[model samples]
Target: MPKQNSIAITGAGIAGLSLAIRLRQTGHSVQIFEARPREASGEGAFLTLAPNGINALRALGLAERVSSLGIPTTGIEILNAAGRRLALLDEREAQRQAGAASITLRRADLLEALRQTASAQGVDIRYDHALIDIERKADGVTLRFGNGESAHAHWLAGCDGVWSRTRRLALPASPEPLYTGLTGTGGFLDCPHVPSSGGVLRLMFGESAFFGYIKAQEGPVFWFDSFTLDEETAIGRPDPAALAARTRAQHAGDAAPVRDIAAAVTSVPRAYPVFDMGHLPRWFDDRVVLLGDAAHAVSPHAGQGASMAIEDAVVLAACLTAYGAPSRAFRAYETLRRDRVEHIVRISRRRGAKKQAKGPVALFLRDLLLPLLLPFDAKTTQAVQRYRADLDPLVLPAA
Candidate 1:
C-alpha cells in the first residue's frame, strides 16, 4: 500500500486491532506494530465484557465472533472475609438496561481473536516492532520502530496504551500516568472440586486483600485479586511459580478456595502496578493522535478498559472518515470521548479504593454501610452498562 493511502497504528492490543479493522473495511491501508511476539498469549487473567463494550464490538462486526469465544457472566457476588453477603450486582438486569449481559473470557483469547480478524481483513500486523520515535512530515508522519524499520502514513493513531511512546514523542509536555499505589496478580485454576459460584463471580473482600473467582459450568475456575505494592517495590519480574507463592501468602487465611484456587493455578498470571490517567490536556499533535488506553488509562476495576477502547476505535474511525482533515477529525474525536472516559476513570478509582485493605474500624463501617448504599450503586452500574457507541455520522465539534 502506498503511503498516500495508508494509516499507521501503534500497539496491536484491543484498541489498535479494532481500529485497524474499522479503517480497513472503509478502504484505508492500516498497519499495526505490536511489541509482543506473534504468540500474543500469556496476557492477564480473564475480563468481563459489559454490554456497552459489546455494542462497540457490534459496530465493528465482531460482537458475534467475540461473544462466541466467551461465556455469559450473569452477575458479581460481593462478600466480606467473614463470609457475609454484601450485595449481588446481577448482570441479568443488563438485558433491560443495555440489551445484553456481560461475557467473561480470558483476556488473551480476546486479543488473539481480534488479531486474527484484523489479519484476515487485510490489515498488516507486524509483531515485535515496538514503536520508538516519530518524525514530522509535510503531509503525514514517519514512525520509527526499535527493529530499525520505518513506515510513513498519512496519519498515526496511538492505541499503544498508558505509557504510549506515540504520546511521549508527539506530546512531550503531557503529564505522566500516576500510579494508584495498587498492584495485583491473578491466575486461573482448573479445579472442579471447588464448589461452583452458581453463575456469578464470587468476590471476597478479604481482611488483608480482595479476591474474585467464578467456576465455569463444568469447566475451569476463573479468578483474580487486587493488592497494593510497597513504595519502591522490589518485585523484579518474578516467574509464575514465585508469583503464585506470593499471591497465596498475601491472601492467606481469607476463606475456602482463596487458598485452594491459589494452589491449583495453571494459567499464566499477570503482575503489575495499576495506573489511571483520566485527565490529559490534549490527545493529538498535528497528524499524530492518541486512542484508547493511550489517551485514558483507567483501572480494570471499572470493567470498562476494553469497552472504552473499542468505543474509541469506533468514534475515532468515524471522525476520520467523516471529517477528512486530521485537524478537524481529531478535535471532533476528543470532544466526543473526553468527558465520558474521564468520568469512568474517576469511578474506577473509587471502585479500587473500596477494595483497599482497611483497618478493623473501617471494615466495620464498610460492612454497616455497604447494604444501605447498595441501591445507589446498582443504579450506577446499570447506567455504565447502558452506554452505547451511538456516534452521529455528522459530528459537530463540542462547544
Candidate 2:
C-alpha cells in the first residue's frame, strides 16, 4: 500500500519540477523551492533534447507543448575550421533508429515549459527561496531556508544542482567539482547568414580545442570549448562581451564562421565550467535523497546532461510510485539510473578524449574509428530512448 507522505524538492530546474509533478500525481504532496525569484533571469543557454527526453516529457503530457517551442534538428555535420564539411551523420537513419526526432531550444524555454506544467498540476513552487541546510531524522527530514523559514517533510529530494546544499549536507566528503580543463562560452546572435534549411550541427575540431554551432530560432547560437592547461572557473559571472572577445582572440587561426558567431553575440554568453561529477556512494540515505546534477553531472561533450537530468526525474518518481516508500524507492531509482548514467560518463570521457586529439593524424584516426563505432553508439542510445518502467510494481514495500 502507498504511504501518505509530503515531499520537499529543492531546485526549480527540470529534474526537481518533473519529480514534483510525478510524485504529486502519485498522491504525494510536494513543495518546490528555487534560489532565483520568479522574475529572475534564468541560466541563459541552449540545449538539445534527445528522443528519450521528449518521450519522457510526452508521458507527462508536456511533449506537444515543449516540442512546439523548439526547432527540430535534422542532422549533424562535422566541419573543418574553413567551414568545409567533413563527416555527415545519416539524419533520416538516426531518426528512424531512435524512434523520434531530436529538438533543440533555448534552456530558458524548456524551464518555462516545465514550470508551467508543474504549476498547472498544483505543485507548489516557492521562488526566491534558497535551501540553506537539511536535517534528516529517523522519521523525516527538515529543510531550513534562506528566508528564515523551515519545512518538515517525510523526505527531501535535492534537485538543487552542482553546488547543492542538500548534497553537501548529506555527503560532506564528496569531491568538490573538478574542472575538466575546458571552458564553455556561448551566446545567441542575429546572424541571418547561416542557411536555415541546412540546419546541421557543425563541429570543428582542432588541437585540444573544438568549436560548434547550430541554427537557433532567435539566430545562430554558437559556442567555443578549449581544453587548456590554464584552468579557470567559468560559472556565475557573465560578461558576454569579454567572453566573446577572449574566445575570438584565442581561436583566430581556426575558423572564420566560428569567430564571426562569437563576435556577433552582444550579450555575455553563459560560461560553463566543464565538470564531470562521478557517481555518489549512495543516492539516498534515511529521509533525504539527491537527484539530477546534485547526484551526477556529466560533461557537455556528450550533449546529454539536461536530457539525463529529465530522465532521472521521471525515473526517480516512477520508482517512488512503485515502491511506495522513500528508502526502497530511492534504492530502486539508484539501481536503475546508475548503470545508464555511468555508461554516459564513460562514453562522454571517450568523446572528450577525441576532442583532445591533436592535428590531422588524430583526425584521420578518429574518422577511421568513429564510423565503425557509430552503429554501436547509435544502438546504445536506442536502448536508453526506449526505456520505460512501471511505477506501480516498484511501489510494493516490504511486507
Best by TM-score: 1
Off-target runs (Cα >4 Å) in candidate 1 are: 1-4, 40-42, 266-270, 390-399
User: lDDT, candidate 2, residue 31?
Assistant: 91
Q: Considering only N, C-alpha and C atoms within 3 Å, which residue pairs clash in candidate 1?
A: none
lDDT of 2 by residue, 42-131 (tens): 685777777767766755777778878777877777765565665677565656665666787888999888888788888999987888
Give the best candidate by lDDT: 1
Q: What is the TM-score of each candidate against the true structure?
A: 0.94, 0.88
Residue pairs in collision within model 2? 240-268, 322-391, 322-394, 322-395, 323-394, 323-395, 324-395
TM-score of 1: 0.94
| lDDT scores of the candidates, listed in order | 0.80, 0.72
Mark the 10 consecutive residues where model 2 has the least summed lDDT. Answer: 390-399
RMSD of each predicted structure: 2.5, 4.0
